[model samples]
Target chain A: MATTSRVARPRLSSTGDALRPDSNGSTRERLTALAFIAPALLGFAVFYFWPTLRGVYFSFTEYDVFNAPVFVGLDNYRALFADATFGNAMLVTVEYVAINIISQTVLALLIAVLLHRVTRSVFVRSIVVMPYLVANVVVALLFYWMLDAQIGITNQFLGWLGIEPVAFFGDQNLAIPTIALVNTWRHVGYTALLLFAGMVMIPHDVYEAGRVDGASEWKMFWRITLPLLRPVLALVLVITVVGSFQAFDTVAVTTAGGPGDASRVIQYYIFDLAFQRLQFGYASAVSVVLFVILAAVALVQLKLMRAGESDVA
Target chain B: MATTAAAPLDTEALLDRSAGGGGRPRRGPGRILAWVALVLIMAATLFPFLWMIRTAFSNGAALSTQPASLLPVEPTLGAFRRVLGLASTEEAQAQGGSGAAIDFGRYLLNSVLVSVLITAGQVFFGALAAYAFARLRWPGRDTVFFLFLTALMVPPIFTQLPNFLLMRDLGLLNTYAAIVLPFFFMTPFAIFFLRQFFLGIPHEVEEAARLDGAGPLRRFFGVILPMASGPITTLAILQYVQAWSEYFWPLLVASEENVRVLTVGLGIFRAQTPQGTPDWSGMMAGTLLAALPVLLLFAVFSRKIVNSIGFSGVK
Candidate 1:
């Protein structure tokens, strides 16, 4: 049906073009697009939009899985503010996000710049992406063994340096950073690929112009590549910050938010509240708070990114 | 834009160094360091997976040996056999925890079934939606499409509990439906991806078919789909890997042994450990085996995986 309409359109357009100068070909275009997009729109509405609205509504109500929600007004919200665990979770999450964005972004930028200078071999690119492909569970489990403190390879390596064994995950102070470092290692390959793509899209003429201007390698990079790469960097920062806030599975697998909640991210905290404590209403309230925090942060970052780009321009 | 191409003296010196390509001045220290850094990154990535494989096979007693061997001294299929339940769930059971009772066979079957259904649904329904979005004209098209994009920002955690409630209300909890239904329909990301590829294709190809009287359905099935094979194949591989590795949702939904996926089964195993110490050997064995499908997928299609991520990230 769409093809028939599409087929009819050109002939119709010619007739319309000849007879009616006002015809814009808009109707045919719209119908054809509607046919293509309807299914996606329907599915998105049911699975995504409706649920998102439902989530927000449920945040204000008290309900268990067995019963319909009973409106409790701002009670859940009040308890959320009063909860000490919630406070700790907020602090830990902010710290985690800060650590993740800084470390991962810096490493990704460095690797991307380095890889850009190297040969653009397919094999090299594949090797660079290999770490990102490994499942989070596998990485967490692997690190668990490697950082086992006594029988672990990390301690064994330290032993050779004649240093005492260090419990990487066992110590409260070391736990979050160790996890953060591992997170950085797993993500840098993936992030580098993003930066590399941005690098490749840069026109060669710009680099050549920089070369002709007697720019040093460092100067050329700072002046030419970094500015061109702004969009990708902004993208990486947005996704990284958002992802850090949502960190759950790795902590679940590795630390179980342990060493007394040192590594407990907001997602993990939410999970414990909803599942373990069975505080469905309170968790919903927490989720609402999280949603607000993320939205504010994203909006601010987006504004900053646009402002920075405009400044560069 | 106009300037000298570096100082003539500097270019001449650099060119001379480049000309001595094989011995003392062949590769600069910079180039060597670059290669070294590349090699180190590769090692860092590969080392954990290698260690997992070795540790999975190493005997518990041998693992405790001083100055532990990186390679298992007596590498055995013992762990693999135990995990596959070709030996006995008893060895696993003796090791104790939720794993002791875990039926690896059931979990494997559950994972395979769920992954297959989700992949099939995403390809079929997602293609239909993507095709519509790509080719068919509609009212409020971009507005509606952007609405779908906003769904990406809602975060999975937001939908997770509500969906579970929906499943519970439907009495589909503890069933595969709970795990599969939310993902079975068209997703915004997949729609956007397929639409991007579809938009790049010239209308002339479809127009030619239309002129030859090929129906819309016929053109879609015979032409558009075949042309869109690369993205479809890539999406399938990704959706499969994702479904196979998913932990939290499955844990939340499926409580029965028969419905348990590998991730939840591992979780149960983790929970069942006696005292403070976990059954490290058994747990590692299970964890390694559980990651096998994704590992295999990654090994086979690292390029596609990376390219897809890059593509999505940029968009």
Candidate 2:
């Protein structure tokens, strides 16, 4: 209990107290803080700040490999809008984000609620968090074999139910779903782990009050649990949305944008242009579009989430 | 209004009757169904991993017989041997021929070296920057910090071409620098994470050290840093796992065999196979090797990693 209190204590008061004039150590203390922070600040500017400036500038130039960038004056942005592949990539990205947002959050919440109620043993807690430890590549590889239609265990199990072997990765309809399912499988555990932490922090007396009122489990969950969980839920949703917009690796590895680029997500498309086709300017323009999309989505989501919190209170 | 007040007396009498009825040996079917549903979901969740372990041990001959065995009727160490390079050509050919010759040991060593160096660099630079951002009074610190945060949402692909150009110009291509340099330095995520942890730490501790006549560097090195060891270690573990698992950036730059990390190497190896029918056994072997560093890190710092995910999101 004391340790929990210590962990929960605010640090501002302590710091304010230390800054009192009679201490005679104020100037030296500030100097020490500055010294500690200098190395990081220097690296941040050179690596992050400078490159960010360069990225914005390069978006307007036509630069292929083996040549200096020449100012193109919005030609790259024009080409991006006119490109068919960009449209397809945009469609694919929407489907991916939509499916992932719904599935990852809902399943994460369900699993979190389930895990929160595990009263039998503490061992369940550790086992529940294990999948998040596995790398994305490993998860991808695992799903690749599992969905291989020929020797895949998923197909083999379906055969037992008298269903024909399905081309999960090959089919246009199945490809996005396959990737979404695999992503959800890998991330659900991690998301649930976070949600469970939120659940754990809720004071026990609130639940007891619901019990005293003879509230049904569903009613209590809807009225009490979810309202209290809005902050963490909102946080996860925003991050997931931004992350889904950047989805590249799993699709790249699983299908390589195959079956005539059926799973050609925007990020992968941008990558092919920059690296494979040497269209650096065009890729940067698409990247800027993606950045705008993500920024807008995040901003709207934050506003709605804040509104939800106010409404609940 | 008088009837509304009198209704409570009638509800009290009914509640007393219902309480007696509720204890009459009846159980809620909803609760029972919820438990059953939970068990089924758990099984569904865990079955894939169980099947993976089973598949890793089975071979081609037994892999496709009438009524294929669920428990590996003729289990063999052949797959593991071929993966680890102990099998002869006959065993290799039986699995999927020359395609499975991934040289897992070499790839394993490469991954370890890259991940370790990247993790060390990320933590060091992240700490320095985080310290500055958290405690230092610098010109335009908040603006610079926000700029770095914007990098987090930029979708790494945006910077790929530019970074590639920069790296090529510097002649860092086809080297460990290609894989490590871009990422081995400070990451915004790490800096943000560490800054939040640092902000949570009390200033009194460092002030107390200063009162002892210790200089700024001494207070930071001796006081704030020691206090931050928990979160610093957590960030290190997260960065290590991410660096070990990174595929795309490394895929873009590390084209040469000499500098190829495991993830890219595996992809290229898979692509070069006959008609793109990737050598399943070898890919699995390569994947297992690639996953070792992350798995080991998790084993060492399971609690810290799990806790960090929550703390990381809090900021």
Candidate 3:
């Protein structure tokens, strides 16, 4: 595949040559390569490899940090299966994920389309993404203050319009939606940029050919843009859904899963079970369940979207 | 570099209006409406964000009085003083801050130290591993790199408890080691990112370095790494932002005051709300302090960041 050509390919275009192992696989070369990868491999084996296996292993055993782990085989899973709190958490997490994915994908699509028309300068692009550049805790605190019922800027502004003050985080019914909205504010810009990337990749000749055939802008968008945009939308959905499931900092800082367990999503539930109640085994079981669900969700989504298939289709 | 605070908006030329035939300009009511709606949306999205800066500069006592004011209420630096621990407890309470101190200056230092160490170590080792994968021919090289990539699919929550117990067993909990070690080593994403770049580099130069009798390490440091300064810088910026803004891992292991990073510090500040009203002004000031480094870095390298935008599903 490398062709043994003298003139190199363009600097960024990827080639499949990596799949072909080098012809000279001498022992000295192998040892040198091993040495090169050793430090990273050490880190990978320790932090990622060992910890992941140990985490799953810990789920089947009972350990209190004070004593050796006692193997309890499926008890943690059985308890979690019947746990109402876990059920509530999963439901709440799904509720949170649904709101976040739909709103973020739609809003980010809007922003990207608009910016594609107006300007795409790095300065303007950077401004839109600035909110996303900070920690979730920053925006969480920011919106938490602005949305405060009593004297928050949002409520104060709403009062000018003669509307009653609404409790965003304080009301159980409003808490989950508010969390989703807050994260949307943080992410919509970045997701817009992500969609914009997908838009930029669509070949110019596709649109040129459309215009030559007298296709209107709206017509072109429907026929050309939306179909091409599907894979990107799927990607943003998977990303936002996964991150939304693990939404912790905002919940931790703003509501702390309060207002009567309305905002107690699964990740927060895992955290509380482990740290607050010191039930490490139950928490690990919950994590395994979450991992499985997330993996299944990702697989289902990729399959449904037919990612990496023809954009025109 | 597709890690966090700001990821590779990795796909370049994000808004290439000129490239598309649909970018045609036409005067119409629909265009006007679209423009107006764009302004409105940008306004609604960005307008509320200014509240943090406005509140940070205002005295805490004035927030209750001027909750909706355009200019800062009783514009003062007292809240910042309160966060930085420059004000005494009496002064803090008198100015509507909690009596407990936040000491953001100390946390800022911790954040800088921690973020730098992570970026430096992660980039260096990640680059090495990436080189091996990209430039060297060896047994199981691709397989090993594929295994490293599998770790990217494992969420931080899945490994949270085991890592915690490992740290506790090693007596490193509440220390910087626990806060740093989990990410201090190579991240799969980091390796993947560097390997992609390393693969793109002209093999001619590396071949010349080899002919000069340079060893593997020498060729790496002397030739390839220097040639990769552009991507390396991009990776470092992305990695630094991620390291600085990390919340979950640090929150789990190093919630103690001294080792606390700015994010966890801000959380604690928010949690310590006084009896009546939350310390809105003081907490906002802390948030500003926490966010400044990342924002400043973005401002400095925004063009570099924007030009390097690639979507690798980094979140």
lDDT tens readout by residue for model 1, A85-203 = 88998988888877877988887887887766654555677777766655566567668768877788889989889989998877888878888777777778878877776566555
Name the lDDT value of residue A234 in candidate 3: 66
Worst ten-residue run, lDDT, model 3 chain A? A1-10
Cα error, residue B264 of model 2, in Å, equals 1.7
Reference-based lDDT, residue A15, model 3: 45
Once fitted onto the true fold, the runs of candidate 2 whose alpha carbons sit more than 4 angstroms away are A1-35, A119-122, B1-32, B66-68, B72-74, B84-90, B137-139, B274-277, B311-315
Clashes of 3: 6
Ranking by lDDT: 3, 1, 2
TM-scores, each model vs. reference: 0.86, 0.87, 0.93
As a TM-score, model 2 comes out at: 0.87
| DockQ class, candidate 3 | acceptable
- C-alpha RMSD over true interface residues, model 2: 12.4
Alpha carbon lDDT of residue A238, candidate 2? 72
All candidates' lDDT scores? 0.68, 0.66, 0.78
10 residues in a row with least lDDT, candidate 2 chain A: A1-10
